[model samples]
Every structure is written in structure tokens, then in C-alpha cells.
Target: MANSPQPPLDALYQEALATFDTLLSQARGEGDPEPTAMTLASVEGARVSARIVLLKGVDARGFRFFTNYRSSKGEQLAAHPQAALCFHWKTLRNGVQVRVEGRVATLEAAESDEYFATRPRASQIGAWASAQSQTLADRAEFEARIDEFERRFECVPVPRPPHWGGFVLAPDRIEFWYGADFRLHERQCYERDADGAWSRRMLYP
Candidate 1:
């Protein structure tokens, strides 16, 4: 079934994704820098951590990002296999906030390799040099590791780290919120079904 024609994405899903694209574009036009930045929240047991991560890609399947497999967030995702993302574009007319809840899974090795190849040489080096989310004795030790990797990869292409790759979140629910005057905001929620269909509804603000 290689290269076989695949069925189209669910119509409602496509429409909702297109709306996100339009809003992202509008945020760009409104001069909001870093439109793709989203707050990525992951949990480990009863502990939760939230940090900002840039959205690398998005499609009907879901959102994509890359990180060290051994990092705190990555380990959290490994343990829970679920996460949430929040995107707020403050520069848009009034403002817009989008929240996503989803299950996470590792991306294919080939896809990870393709994206890794496009990274800058320095960043590629960092990927190997960093022991992400691990305690360090000092800053000097980290810089020394970077220097070591740089020398090791000199005159050669840096390969993607085995412990580093990509993850995709297949969203089960997506919510869009718009700011309005007098606190009468607009909220739209879209929930996906097991059969890949979507149901959408408006929520009271």
C-alpha cells in the first residue's frame, strides 16, 4: 500500500484546523512575534510542569515537536502518554486562545531524521552534547561537553541523537476562545470521535 491514495481528513476537523491557520496568519499580520509558541504542559504522577515550546508542524493528524527523549517533559510524556498545549495570541484583535488536549506518541524515525537534518550545525551539535533535564556540576562542564561534540563531529555531518527525536500529539479535543467586551467571550469546542469524525459546539462564556 505504499503511496496509496489516502482518505481525506474529517471535514469538521479540516475546517477547525483551517480556522487555526487563519488566526495564526492574522496574528502574524498584527505583528505578534512567535505566533507558533505554545505552552506545553505535561504531568508526572501528581506533579505537573508547563513550559513554552515552539510548534514545529501541524496537520489533521495533530501537532509536532521535538525534544530529548530523556528530558523532564519527554519523560513525563513517556510516563503519562498525554499532554496539553495552550496557544494565546495577544496581538490579535482583542485576543485569541486555543487549547488542545491529546495523546502523545513518538514519531517515525525517518521523519525525525528528516527534520533533524534541517537543523543548524550548532543546534545539531547541542542535541548530542546536552544531557537535557539532568543536573550539572557547573556551566563549564556543559560548555566542555559542547566543545567535545563539536570536535568529534568536525568535518562530518552531525547525526541525530538516538535519545532525541520527535513526538506528535493526536488531539481528542480542541477549544478556541475569543476575548470580547464586557467579558462576554466566545468559546467553541471540538471533540473527535473514535471513528475520526468530529463534533463541535459553542460553550457559554
Candidate 2:
């Protein structure tokens, strides 16, 4: 039930974030056996592109995700330096969108090394095999590359690719949306202030 009188913007934003986290947990226990991943968007002049990538880490400071540093998103981010992330939980009919304007750079080599060592052997090998965002001749060629990498690194620990790593998006603004009957959805937005604190606002439905 809606609060008979809507609460303050900060309260509303916090409440929506809590609800979204709860719904995400419920979604995880349902049909999808995958981890919570988000579609990351980056721009190039008039073009925008996005792809699903795993959520690697998060904190009050930022959200982090790892990928091949030579991938499409990487290239786009290198040029534009800002990106957005969207997480849609269809089962819950809810979504969270965050617009982050921050500098993008590779994670420390040690950070990447530690994470890579924790990944499954096959994924590590695949990381080396893939020339991410580059077109391959065919499926066979990709498989052949993977096979070659596997053979060359057999009985040895696969090292993290120099061209693969993580990016932390320091969000300047984050919006949480909840769908309601009659299309009067609930929306709460948080914007970072000059003092480095976040100010919350409620948008008209």
C-alpha cells in the first residue's frame, strides 16, 4: 500500500532500494540460476551499445564489473568516460537504472590477478583464447583458439590477460523505479552533491 502521505525523498529512495534488493533475492531463487548481472550502456557520438555483464563488486562509492579491457564497452568507455547500468528483474516487474559519470581505468594488476586465480580453469583459458569484441571467422576458429590456448598452458596456471580487467563506475546519479497499477509508477532518484553526499528526489509518476 502507498504511504497515505508520501515520505521524504531520502526515505522513499532508501525504501525503494531496500525493496529492490529484497526482490532481487526472490528473483534469484526462481527460474534463473544465474548471478545478478546488469546491462551496461556506453555511447559513441550518436550510437549506444549495451551488453549483460556480471556485477563484480559494489559499495557506497561505486559498482564494479570485470571484462576484457579490449572489449567493445572498454573501447567506448575509453572514449566517452561515462556509462550507465540497468538491472531489470522482470519477475518482480521492477528495475534499477544508474547513470555514472566517472573516470574509467583498469583495475590494479594484482587485483585482476587475484580474481583471475579464483575463476574456473576453463574461464581463465577462455579469457586468454578470446580476442573480445573482435570478429572471428567462425565458431570453429574460436574453438580452435581455445584449444590451442588450453594445450599451450596445460599443467600451468592460466594468468590473467593483460587486456582483461575490471572497471568501477562511481555513480553520479542512481534511479530506482517500481511499477504500479495504472502506470503511475514510483520513482526515486539520488544525485551526488558537491560535498560528496547524495541528495534524493522523487520524480512525478
Q: Please list the C-alpha lDDT of all candidates, in the order they appear.
A: 0.93, 0.74
- The superposed Cα distance between candidate 1 and the true structure at residue 38, in angstroms, equals 0.5
User: Would you give me the overall lDDT of model 1?
Assistant: 0.93
In order of appearance, the predictions have TM-scores of 0.95, 0.82
Tell me the spans in candidate 1 whose CA falls farther than 4 Å from its real position.
1-5
Give the per-residue lDDT of model 2 (tens digit) for 11-99.
43355446546756777766545547788888888899988888776654367788887888888888887888877665665433333
Stretches off by above 4 angstroms in model 2 are: 1-23, 29-35, 93-103
Q: 137, model 2: CA deviation in Å? A: 0.9
What lDDT does candidate 1 reach at residue 76? 95
Clashing pairs for predicted structure model 2, backbone only: none
Note the residue pairs that clash in candidate 1.
none
Best model per lDDT: 1
